[model samples]
Target: GVPLSTNEDSTRNQNLAALYVLPQTSYPTFYDVRLFIDPGYTEAFHGNVSIRIIPNINIDQITIHAMAMRIDSIRVVSDVNPNEDLFSDFTLATDDTHLLTIRLTRNITALQPHVIHIDYVAQYADDMFGVYVSTYEENGRTVNLVTSQLQPTFARRAFPCYDEPALKAVFRTTIYAPAAYATVRSNTPERRDSLKPNEPGYVKHEFEDTLVMSTYLIAYLVSNFNYI
Candidate 1:
């Protein structure tokens, strides 16, 4: 035999129900029951059940590439409110050619509306394609020259980010070089453009704003690389 009771709570618009079952057989038997609990069952369950709801957030794709040098490391600085770190979750790869990928972290929910800063270093390799360097034969004499126009492909061969024409972000770059190189160019106009005072052979150049662009769209060139 079973006894049932139902009551309605008008204030909360909830139905509270209870059921009592009495054993009719000598042996215990299993029974299948279904309970249609209200959507707001916190009070009825006395807060014993915990439910977690995650919001739907959009994540942007990022990619990177490196050129002319081997990338030793990549660092990602998160802009979380409590200052959380997100460097450990990024994926990095590099071949002798210019290409890298920065896979987004799975828990990108924590990085909503935040800026990520990436820093890396690369070493110069001999230009096999003569893109960054130029060669000319004058009167049967061999002349070798370097040019800055190869920045789009050569400079970007360092780290992975968005690498298309339209996908762009604000970026700041500082280039280190020997004392002879005096000129550097970036997509954005220079702001604090100067050489490192104490450091003899390093030039610290910065840009103010960058147009929306892909990672490959970023370009920089350094010539006669010298410090102050």
Candidate 2:
């Protein structure tokens, strides 16, 4: 039986959580996993990424998830001759979720396209940002508190993709998480979100996209958190 346990190492656990190991079959073997990126804010962006190809695989299905942003265009710049623009036949809009899939029609001679580039902006959210706290008092007053992992849930929540790390993609996430929240985190250290004053219970968190990574590895936890 496959071993199962709660993940402890934040980094290693994040990678493991993003992967799905399937059972062996009688014939050929292939694995299909979804991928996502948070293109924070950039006019032009480019990235190179790689994925380990499992032996005995015949094909790979590549899908891109872009939601709530304007995708002026997308083009396949490598791997194939003639540089095909595959985005035309692809689906651009989802029920508030944007998902596009492309089958690698040809065998890959090199690891490319596995690294993708994206350009987009981060929009604001009403429900996407908020403070939910659980508190208790020592003597009839409240003291303890808790906050949401709004980065993965709120920030990326607006968009739809694999939303994990093992399915790493060159993520370029530019958006507003919130202002009251001091810090934000992504797969890469590219840019930071800006803060501005707003109505009650409102702020902004704008950051740059992330590095090449699986969907699940894309994570952010915001709050006054102290790790032991």
Candidate 3:
């Protein structure tokens, strides 16, 4: 096995309870995140994340963190050729509960910008952390809401990310849900919302890009629950 760096040794277990700490070899400078909730009570929430990053060193593998998600796809695109995609030539493995190691065909240029895209189905936890379902009584009916609590290391449960408290990045987030469930909130304020024509009964709420912040500080919610 390759020797783990001090950063890795310290962060490998940084999850809410784990003790391994993953090293910081690459940094995501920006992230574009989109989520689609079932509207009804469901644990299967779809997510799409696009991240712009700069690697600290030239390397053939990219290791990040993820947990409790079913990844459908992973791809990389270089800024030099935005039209070209490098999805077919890579292998991704999430062998551990909080580790996702991606092996690429070629070495990524050191300090150069690259974009990573991931499509996945993430679970809504009952644990009340990292994109979970919340329940409450409303108007004489039991209401279920979809929300996110990414504090500490729970961000990986919602989406693939560095999952560290020190790795901060800008985020452009969007949430898709039934129009009837109108309200959505995130770390930042809403930019605009539009009907999802192809997916009837759904509206996509887009939020403005966020100030640089750690993944743990990220929060989002989709609910019909009234605000006091």
Best by lDDT: 3
Q: How close is candidate 1 to the true structure, as a TM-score?
A: 0.47
Which has the greatest TM-score?
A: 3
Q: Using TM-score as the measure, name the better of candidate 1 and candidate 2.
A: 1
| lDDT per model vs. reference | 0.35, 0.36, 0.79
By lDDT, highest first, what's the ranking? 3, 2, 1
Q: After superposition, how far is residue 9 of candidate 3 from its true place, in Å?
A: 14
Write model 2 residue lDDT over 1-228, tens digit each, in one string.
996664556668766644332212111111111112122321212211222222233334445444444443333334444455333334554554444443444543333333223333333332434122333455685443323234442323333344333444454443233343344443445344443232333333434544454454444434322431
Tell me the TM-score of model 3: 0.84
Please provide, for model 3 over 1-228, each residue's C-alpha lDDT reduced to its tens digit, 9 standing for 90 to 100: 997578766665455344345656788999888888854858578888998989899877777888888888888878988776655443334455477777776787889898989999887877877788877887798888888878878999888898888889998888888876777888887885542223556777888889998999888888875671
- TM-score for each of the candidates: 0.47, 0.36, 0.84
Candidate 1 local lDDT, 1-228, one digit each (tens):
685443535433432211111111111011111111111111110001011111134432333343443333433333354265444444444444344443444445622443334444333234532124435566796543333333344434333333233334444434333334455555667665442232343444555545443444454454543331
Residue 86 lDDT in candidate 1? 42
Instruction: Mark the regions of model 2 whose C-alpha exceeds 4 Å error after superposition.
Output: 1-61, 79-86, 96-98, 102-115, 129-161, 169-228
